[model samples]
Each structure stands twice: as C-alpha cells, then as structure tokens.
Target: MTAAVFNHEGPWTEEEYLALGETQQRVELFDGSLHVTPAPTPRHQNISGELRAALRAPVREAGLHVLEAVNVRLRPGRIPIPDLVITGPIDFDELNVEAGDVRLVCEIISPSNASTDKVLKMHYYAAAGIEWYLLVEQDSGTMHLYRRRGGHYTEQSVTRPGDLLVLTEPVKATIRPEDLVP
Candidate 1:
C-alpha cells in the first residue's frame, strides 16, 4: 500500500491519482490536489451503520442502492468519498461513480473536518448535479438536509436527535436521529 502523502507533492492529475495504489486512509482529490485524511473513528462508523440500516429496506423497495465511503468522481479534478451514497444501481468497471449517478450524498462531520464537509464538499456535490445532500453532525445527532436548486443547494430539513427524519426525495424513509449514535 502507498503511504499517505502528507506534504504538497504538487498538483496531481486524474490519471496520476488513479494509478496510485490504495491505502487504508481516506484521500480526496480537489482541483488537482490531494488531501489525505485519517480513518474514521468507531463513532463515525456507528452513525453510518445506523443510517444505512434504517434506509436498507426503503432503498431495496425503491430499487435504489446504498453504499458506504465510496469514491465519487464528481468531475475530472474533484473526488469525494461520502459517508454514504444513495444512488441507482449502476454497472461499471471503474473504481468510482460519477456525481450524476448519485441521488443523495451523506457526510458525517468529523470534528476536525467540519469545514471541508460543510463547505467544500457541499459546494462540490451541488455543482455536480447531486440533487440531495445530507450533512450529519457526528456528536449531536443532527441532520441538515440540503436540496439542489438552480446550481446550488438550500436547506430543506434540520432534524434533531428525537425527530423522526422523513426523507422524501429520492425515496421515502423514516429515521430516528438518536439511533445514529452508539
């Protein structure tokens, strides 16, 4: 496995990035640069699992697919791995999915990566034609849902720990925010 590239190794091209070997850590591509992050903690995994569980039946019923921490190539120089992705079942040979293939992209905000998730990724997902984006607050069990409109996204729902989060766009599923915590 390739070691994490910490320092600026100069801007990387798409081909160069794809040719590199995979490591256990998370590495995102943005504007031809590489940003490597550490693996998620157990708390992050728990939240992702809870939501995935809640959505499984609904996703199957609707004939949609859900995956965890997969690479999404939104554009040539933009790639982001969301905590979960809700999209149609697609058959492809590549290691990543195009942003157009995704209906909803979910990110659980890590304390140190809040800005990247809330700002940078939010903008990228919207710009790439992803219709829905879910930003989960890892510590507080809050979900901020954003819907794309006119090249941008606007907040559609702010669900708290006790709220029964009802998603209606790509599919209909009811989730409890509290269940997202361990």
Candidate 2:
C-alpha cells in the first residue's frame, strides 16, 4: 500500500499516532509522511525472538534495555518502529524514543520491506546517529550489520546461520548466526 503525500504542516500527536496502531501494521512517519509496511510472518517472529533471547542475558546484566517493535522518534516528524532496538535504559511507552538514547536498532527484512529497510531506513538511522543497525533477512537466512560513521554507515558485514554478530558500540554483544535464524 502507498501513503499519499499529505499537505500536513503540524506534527502528529501521540493520540493520532497510537490510533494507527490498531491494525498491527508497521509504518514509519517521516516528515509528516507515513510509510506503511506489512506485518511480519511467523518465521520473522521466531528470528526476532531468537535475537532477543541471545542478547537478553548480556543486556540485563549490563543494565541495558532491549525492546521490540517500538516507535523511535528521530526528528519532529520522523519516527520508525524498528523490529528490535537496544538502549542502555529503555522506556516502555509507545512514543518514548528521543534522539540519542538508542544505541543500536535492527530490522527484519521481508519481501515487502526489503528496499525500505536496506536503503531508506539505513540512511535515516545513520543520519539519526544511532550507533549500529542490523538487518536480518529470514528468506535468505542472512544478517547484514552496519555501523554509523560520520553521519553515514561505513561498515557492512554479512553473516549466515553459522556466523557470529560482533557489535562495536554500547557493549560487546555477540550473537551466533544460528541464534538469529528461525
């Protein structure tokens, strides 16, 4: 589905934002424009859960917060609900993300969201100064990791179901490839 380019001038409020959450659909708000994405499949959920479980131990011990599918406000009207996001301390509220609290954000790629996740969201996340971005594609069983550098993502690494994800920032959290594949 495509979202019309609205002539809206005001910022979308919390109520209006939450109202759209009913469909259980995933969409991102960028400068008053909305980009809608399809709901993930069962395999997507399994991989996401696996990623969460792999990191939960280190995250909890380090007092870091790991959240799934929450709106991370990048600017006045730019908010993207990353599939998985980890912060030092997390706020469970719907519209809770500020600018820099998010250390690493991730997305699980499905057929409908491949381009947006790999290109659009990658650029935006780098611009937002989020330290790391992880993209997992369940179809191919591949994970691509990107690290932000000088307002852009400079490091790109690809891993399959047997590799390990080594993160550089926040904490040195690692995830085996098997842990991320459904």
Candidate 3:
C-alpha cells in the first residue's frame, strides 16, 4: 500500500503496523516507528535473484531455508523485511520469522538504502544475535561479509569483482561479485 495509509501522527503500534498489510513498497517497523522504502530497481532484483540462485543449493543442502524479501521479527515492534534470509526451520503458515531462527540476513545496497544497510541494520542484526550479515554493494561490484562477535559485527571478508566470496560458516558457497548482475 501507500504511505497515505499510515497518516497517523504518532508511532505505530505493532498491531497497527501489522494491520497495514502487504505493501507495494518495503515497510518495516522499528521502535514503534515505520520506515518505508521504495521498491527496488530492476538491477537490484537481478542481483538478489542471482545471489539467491547461487546460494540455494548449498544453503538447502545445509538444511536451511533461503528466502527473499521476508519479514524478520527481530523483537517486538522491530520487524524488518530483509532482502534475503538464511533461516532454520520455519512454518510456511507464519507471517514472519523469529530472530532466533535466523542465521544470516543479506541486503543488496542501493543508493537509497546504502547508509541504512551499512550501518543501522548492521547494528540491529548484530544486537539481535544473528550470526552473519552479507552486504552487496552494486555500484562497486563488491560483497562484504560480517560475523557477529560480542553483540557487534566484525568484517569477515570483502570480495571484489574479480574474486570469489567463499563462505563456510552458515553454508559452504562461493560467489563472484560480477555474477550478481546480468
């Protein structure tokens, strides 16, 4: 839906936030506040699709679920729709996945969400005890992987265009940055 549907002047309650229902744009709830982001561009979709395809086999082999654009409830009133999530068993009937079940969350950075992805969400994901975070910077053709350490995230690796991103913790998979785009 449109932002007009959320014309209230105060912070939204979790019930109200959920009541807003499926939106055309990406909508998240943080501290009772709503953060609305525009739908991703075609290039962003291409990268997400490609990355998901690359991770699918290995992630599934590890007995994990790799999902796209799914609601992740970090805590009460703190639900974020991550671009990609590698999670443990979750019932398909549930509206969202719990933070405890999630192993990794990935976000493909675009101009509009660079800061949020690189900083804000990083802190949130780490604080919630999620083990890994993957960031794909489309403009630079790079991917940065982070591992959680003591309520914070430490950079695990940075893979550039010509190199392969080899990950083994959550799953064993290798991906090339350039291959993320068409």
* Per-model lDDT: 0.88, 0.77, 0.90
Question: Which of 1 and 3 is ahead in lDDT?
Answer: 3
- Strongest candidate by lDDT: 3
lDDT of 2 at 144: 84
Best-performing candidate as measured by TM-score: 3
- Residue 180, candidate 1: Cα error in Å is 0.7
Runs in model 3 deviating more than 4 A are: 3-6
Candidate 2 positional error at 33, Å? 1.4
Q: Runs in model 2 with CA error above 4 Å? A: 1-15, 18-22
Q: Model 3 — TM-score against the truth?
A: 0.96
lDDT of 2 at 142: 76
State in Å the error of residue 165, model 2. Answer: 2.1
Residue-pair clashes per prediction, in order, are 0, 0, 2
Question: What is residue 167's positional error in candidate 3, in angstroms?
Answer: 0.8
Residue lDDT tens for model 3, 1-182: 56555467787888888888888889999987888899999999999999999999999899998999998999888999999999999998888899999999999998987899999999999989999999998775599999999999999999999999999879999999999976
> Between which residue pairs do clashes occur in model 1?
none
**What are the clashing pairs of model 2?**
none
Against the true structure, what is each candidate's TM-score?
0.94, 0.84, 0.96
